[model samples]
Target: MGQVITFGEVLMRISPRGKKKFIQSNVVEFFFGGTELNVGVSIANFGGNVKHIGVVSEDFIGDTAISYINKFGVDTSSIGRSKRPLGVYFFEVGAVMRPSTISYNRSHSSFSEIKPDMVNWDEALIDGEWLHWTGITPALSQGSFDVLKEGLQKAREKGLTVSADPTYRRGLWQYGKDPKEALSELLHYSTIFIGGINEINEILGTEYSYSNEDFIRASKQLMQAFPSIEKVFDKIRTSLNSSWHKIRARMWNGKKFHETKDLDITHIVDRVGTGDAFAAGLIYGLRRFDDCKAMEFGSAACALKHTYEGDVNLTTVSEVTTILEGDISGRLNR
Candidate 1:
């Protein structure tokens, strides 16, 4: 298989240990992750060839972050450096009835300084078969949006499949550009839509409810609006509480609509990056299995991510397959 190229920021995530509020705990834990980086790392752990392109601080912190990604076997050669501190976010992990909260401090970080000229799209897309991008990257700054647009254009010219996950955050789009306009332009270059009805409604400025029927309608409207989008995949989550949640996946691949059984996660260790795991699983699966099986793989991967603590899903292909085979008992293996 050719390489999967992921482009976005690399962030250092800090969290209080074990559901403790910031005021209740003096200790914190840190992990390296970003939306696209998490997807790239998970795919790499699945034994797929993956490369991540982003910017980090030109310091030891950046060195450590690169080491973390390198240990996962993701190619980091395309990553660049700048004379700014690495972006950092503080995540307060909640449990039971409490909801998790995140605060970002990435306004002047190195990734926000990225420019289209810094990335040699020809070199990055040379061996790439798929390119993955998220709305967060473009929401950072105009420069990031331009760079991502340029990369998407290059990927299109090279005939590489482009996956767009418009993980929209109203707060992130502090730049003057309209979120709908920016995301709409990027969606034009993407072939796979890794989001749901809410996202589609947000981009298209429509009122689509959460019903499955509305989901199908919204997806069809989305495909009609953006002819480049061939498939739509969504990970539906039903949260019982911050710690207990259920996940399932549904997809409309032009011809048929498929949905998977809900994978109940009674205890969630960390909820961050689960969506990225689903995206990674789908990308890996679509290249190997049929559409229905691929959606199942994505949902299984997403369910397994809750068992890990960090921002990236560390589960291997065998582990995910075990879950897919109906083995969520957490049984001992000798």
Candidate 2:
């Protein structure tokens, strides 16, 4: 199998412990996480050769982030150092009837300060067969968008299959350009895309009515607009509460639509990296399984992530396979 490459920031995530509000908590826990970095870690945990490329400050927080990435068996040799501060976020976990909240302290961080010339794309993509990135990266700053665009161009040139999570965050795109325009350029180079119905309408200018036909229509329109696109997919989440959610996934693989079983995920330990888990699982499955099986595997992997308490899904392929094979029995294994 070919190696996977991802480019984005690695942030230090701080959250209160055991249902404690940020204001009330006396103790806090920290974890290393970011969209692309989370995916790289998940892929590595699944026994895939993966590399995480990004900029980090020459501080202890940056050192911890790089060490965390390496601990997961992800290659961090391409991680560059900067003088800027490392990015960090404060997360407040919510209980029933209340929603979780996140406040970013990521502005001016080393990764957001990245320049287009900092990375040698040729060297990064040398042994890479797949390249992954998220829309969140470009939303940070103008310089970040430029580097992301340049990376996409180089990844294309190297014949690396590109997958992107079109994660639209309104707060981060303060660089004075419409997100639709910036994301359109990146989407043009992506072969596999992951997003929701609302994101489709917002970014691709397609009217999604939550119907099966409209999904197929929108998927076809998206592929037509960007000829390089081969597949578009999404994991639909139905939140019963902050602690419980039912997740079902679907994919439009150019010719047809495929949907997976709905998984009722309860007592979610940490919901932050579930989407990245699905993305990683989908890419992993695409390398081995058919579209239907791939979607199922991805959905199963994400469901398993709810049991873990960090940003990265530490679950192995065999664990996910057990869930995929309808063994959600939490019984102890000998």
Candidate 3:
């Protein structure tokens, strides 16, 4: 089995205890999470050897972040320490009919200030068969973008399969550069992309309506523009309330489109890292199953992530396979 290597930031996520509002909370909970790092944890939990590469502050806060990811069995040897402080964010869990909210305090963090030389691509990527990243890294700063571009170049030279999640956080892209320019250059080396049509429009400058036909048009446009991309996928979500969501997913594998059935989730424990969970599942499925089965397994992982509290999806392959097989009975096993 080959190793999956993820490149991105690891943030210190602070949440209010329980369903309390941020202002009303007396206690807080902290965890380490970020786009690529979250996917790394999910793949590791599924029994895959994964390596996470990012910078951490030379402080205890950074130490804690490293320990958190390490707990999930992800290799942290490439996560270096620096003088800048670790990035952090605060979010409040919302119940039915109320929407969740997030506030970030991540500027000037170690990972954001990272340079291309900071990450030794040749050493960090040794024995790495898959490389995963997200748009969030490029949105951080020019320095982060440069590092990502260099890393992606090296990953391509090494003949590794590259996957990316275009997580376009509006507020994170205030670094005075157009996201399209930065992302397009890096995505030229990507083989798999996970994001919605809106994200594709924002980053690729293509007009795509939320219709099924338009999705195909957009996917074709994307693949044409970037010949390196072989597959484009997205999870279609219908939120009935803060607690209930119905999710299905679709993927365009250059030659055809494959979709999954709706996985209704009426009780969402946490929805923070569901997309990353889906990305991990898709990567896992692509290696072991066909496109249709991969979409089903990936969507099942997304649905199951809603029942977990933290950013990392701790569900196993057997558990996800059970859900994919229509065994969402939630019954106990002896």
Candidate 4:
């Protein structure tokens, strides 16, 4: 088993319970979420030797984040704590006919201000074998983008396997320049690429498409463009309305391809970190089983994430094993 390392910001997610806006909020729940840190936590929960690499504010909020992370047995020594303020996300959950919304207060996030030297690129993943990153990181600022490139170069030199999923938060990107150039640089460095086609199209410079075959072909072009990359994966969605969606995914594993039927993800509590959950599952399978069996296992884990309530997935290894053994009926487990 190899160690896993992830780099990105960690935010305190404050979300309203039922159907209350931020101004009209009476009840709210607090859960920590940042795509990269969430992925690190999930990997740690599965007993992976995981270390979250990023900068955190030296304030009370940063302390709070570290406390919760410590409870999960994550290594925080490598996580830098600075004199900055922590970042947060305000979310408003919606009911059947309503739509949910999330607002990020991560403008001056500690991790966003990261410099290349903050992470000793050559030393960070010295004991690690896998590195995972999200698209959200490079969208922060020029310094962070440089830091990612520095880190990726080191990871490549160390012969580490890299996985990237550009979750595509278009709202956060338009900082200084276009997102295409930066996104492409990072994608070229990744071996396991996981993302959605619609969000990726903007970065790939393509036109509108409602065709599945077209998506696979375009995604294939990207995979072929980067010979270092072994697989290209993305989730597909058919929206019936604001709150209801039918979601499925397809994968191209260098040699063969596979796709699954869309699962009705009606009880979506937090659709934010589901993509990371899928990537985590996929990588876990790829490391454990052969190519074909791996994607099947990954797709099952993602389908299970839809039924859970938080950004962190609740599917246990035993549950995933059951699903992997050809059971998507998802009966209750008590």
Q: Tens digit of lDDT per residue, candidate 4, span 213-320?
A: 776676677776666877877767676655677767788776777787666766665566777777777777777787666666667677677666667765767777
Give the per-residue lDDT digits (tens) of candidate 3, residues 1-334: 7899998988988998888897897899987899899898998988889999999999989888888888988999999899999999899999999999998888989898888778899999888999998989999999889988998999999999999887787788998988888788888989998988997898777788988788988999888888999999999999999999999999888889877889999999999999999999988888788988887888999899999988889899999989977898999999
Which model, 1 or 3, shows the larger lDDT?
A: 1
- Report every candidate's CA lDDT: 0.94, 0.88, 0.89, 0.77
Cα RMSD of all models vs. native, in order, equals 0.8, 1.0, 1.1, 2.1
User: Which candidate's TM-score is highest?
Assistant: 1
Task: Work out the TM-score per prediction.
Answer: 0.99, 0.98, 0.97, 0.92
Between prediction 2 and prediction 4, the one with superior lDDT is 2
Q: Which stretches of candidate 4 lie over 4 Å from their true place?
A: 208-210, 326-334
TM-score for candidate 3: 0.97
The clash number for model 2 is 0
lDDT of 2 by residue, 193-217 (tens): 8886877788777678888788888
Better of 2 and 3 by lDDT: 3
Top model number, lDDT:
1
Q: Candidate 2 deviates by what RMSD?
A: 1.0
Better of 1 and 2 by lDDT: 1
